[model samples]
Target: MAKFTGDTAKKILANEINVQTLLHQHPEYQEEVLRELSIMKGSYDLKRIQAMMNKYTSSAKLAGNLIYKSGFNEKTVNTFLPNIIKARMALHLLEHASIAASAQSPTKNVRFNLWDGMVLQRLLFSKGFERKPVSLGLFNFCWKFVLNKKILMPLVNQKGIYCFYSKALIRELIRLIGDKKCLEIAAGDGTLTRFLNDAHARCKATDDYSWEHYITYPDFVEQADAKAALFKYTPEVVLCSWPVPQNTYEKHVFKTSSVKLYIVIGTRNPAFTGDFGAYNEAEQFTMELNERLSSLILPPSNENAVYIFRRKEH
Candidate 1:
């Protein structure tokens, strides 16, 4: 019998080893039994993963190997590994009643909406699993997956400020706003604005008062009431991120003078406009704006719904 060393125990707890195979080979221990034992006998839990990750000089190399061995393609592995590791650790912690109870206590908790579809979309695309089983499964289980804070904490931390911008999406946005003063309407937390700012474009960020929980930058951030600021700024390029509210104010930005570009980042589904209760008005607004603006640009990525409009040169 192969004796389980601390290293072996750590690997087992990480799901690096097949639990069923371990149990089948060692009938004396049940699968769960082996998992728990591994945790107890080795520093194979959340803290261990974090500590070992620092010690490894080549974390990326090890990550690649793990992804390959786990039967995920490069993209899916890159996208999902950080979140998966975080989720796994969370589950481990939750399995302990004391920790779980403390986490559930109302006094220790506050409110924040987890980043849902966006995070999943990035993970799926990164792992090259955008078309794979894992991606499909993630889509199906998205609600449950993101509902837990533990899974999202690592992703929020890993991606830092640009967690919202997929590399491809950012590139596309940068290309569209080339050498232009850009305005991100409904720029929650200035995520997109930050990206544009980093790309060296002149950009301003704005959001409705409701998004106070998410919007962090005061200098760039402004209340979304268009009349209050639109004519004052006169942006050459205007951008809206997904879940854009179907409001007259959004349409008004398009009407503002000297606005050369209007970009809407969302689903192509005309239904998305209506489904969110802003459909009828937004559709009418889009039609009127389309008549005024020329040269529309749309990308084919199913994950992101993007629409770009260029003002007709007078």
Candidate 2:
């Protein structure tokens, strides 16, 4: 592990260095260089190094040649390789963080290993080691490092359990609804519920617990269908973030007399209208429902939209 001091971190931030440059410049650390290079080979562009190695020596003499070229005579290649690999891994993390920060949808298909690589790179660069291997490592490290900071949520899709939802989205939701009695239907793992609680809302997170592994925070959870739960809680505000397909139970809640406000977070696609035997009668249903509600707020976004309904004042 590289002991990163304040000065080292500052140097990395200033120069934007990484592990790749470090390895290339300090050829004397050939064993370390090779080890780091090997780990990052599949991820980054290592063709240049590979070509150099191929031109210089045979498979058996590879380690010997590296040591000779790197200017290290006393150290064994085997010992050096591990440290090099670790450094490279760190660099990759940094690279990932950099990429993630600049990304539009940062949570899309994020991987943990990639984030780790970026962190390593950032640490190395911060240490003021401006070598080729180190520089490349720095870029890689920043990319991966920022990725680690992301809030990972357990998503339940048709295929099964997966990770989705960005911290930004969660933050936005918190800001939207402050402290209120909230109900989240089709709440997988109670992610939104937890977010609501963190925002100081009196929220009850509920889910069917159908998945093999379900996530729930220390909150009230009832194993019931969305419609049934609505009848029990009759919350002031109802929130559903990305409800399952064809779940007409939402419509049932919309018609309920108890709900003061109903919020549906999802796309505008009509496919979300579940088999409540109501697609053909959507116009009639919506008109009747809208008549009952005082206010309705709809935002225009292809992937995400928020529908808010307010109860009519007596």
Candidate 3:
């Protein structure tokens, strides 16, 4: 019987020491291992789960790896893997969505479906990604965004998913802005800007770069938070995608005198996205959901719409 130390736990997590082999070598350590597994299952720390999720190919593979390493019982593995897999799927969907949204030519219009399985498999588990995890996919699809949305909704509620914009929506937005200087704040990878820019709309993508975990901030995405960006750009039109619920930065957009139109791409449900509290408090602007524009958001399941806010006359 050997004592299980912090070093042992660290080695277990690092994969420096294989749990099955370790337990086989020292059966007495089983109780200690079980305790550690319990802690991991209970914590479900976002960073830790994300790290694990990145290293594996899919939810099934990830769950299998965790179960194999922990050498846990069937009951324990069942309780642990389901939720962890769901979170992992959500993260994967967001990562791929960002990649799809940032496509060089958004007008080509991407859609997701069962046909993408082969491409998805290769990107997720092929040789090129053996040394490093696949952060971006070659294409983006909205139809069947992921194998399971049951796994995606939990994270979407907490951290909203990025949706690809339609050409129609982009054209309409361009028509509305019609020469007004535009700025997109919190633009994850500048997906909307890619479409708007391609359409010759004068818009710049800006973000605080806080979501580096899920989004790889490209060179084109200007590194500025909403308030600082609003102050610097002082554009008449402002655009944002899926602003966090009860956010503090959007309020500044309302206060900025230069902004005449504030466009937000998000769900109507306050619980899903956008700073609703700020929207309600802005007496100076009138908010309306553009149905024609909303239909352009891919997959329809996202329930996302283009919200146009026009400043009321004094």
Best by TM-score: 3
Q: Which ten residues in a row have the lowest lDDT in candidate 3?
A: 128-137
Candidate with best lDDT:
3
Off by over 4 Å in 3: 1-114, 118-161
Which 10 consecutive positions of candidate 1 have the poorest summed lDDT? 291-300
lDDT of 2 by residue, 1-314 (tens): 33333343333322224444545544554555455446545443334333433332233235434644655533444434334334443333322322222232345565547555445434422332211112332344453535454432211121222223334445555655566567887676565576567657777777655432324323455665676677788877777665543333566566666676666555444333222233233332332222111111111123444555566565
| Model 1 per-residue lDDT tens digits across residues 1-314 | 23434444344434544323444565433433345435445432534433332332134336545665766654545453443333333332322321222133232344335475465545543442211112333344553555544443333322222123444456567887888877777565666676677767778887655434333445657765554456667888887765422223455655577777777665544322212333333332342222111211211134344555666553
Each prediction's TM-score versus the true structure: 0.41, 0.41, 0.55
| CA lDDT of each prediction against the hidden true structure | 0.47, 0.45, 0.61
Q: Report the lDDT tens digits of candidate 3 across residue range 175-264.
A: 988988999998876767866887788999998776676666779999887878888989999999877544446888999999999999
Which clashing pairs does model 3 show? Answer: 111-141, 112-141, 112-142
Model 1 misplacement above 4 A: 1-163, 213-219, 243-245, 270-303
Clashing pairs in 1: 75-126, 75-127, 75-128, 76-127, 76-128, 77-127, 266-305, 273-279
RMSD of each: 22.8, 24.2, 16.2
Which one wins by lDDT: 1 or 2?
1
lDDT winner between 2 and 3, please give it. Answer: 3
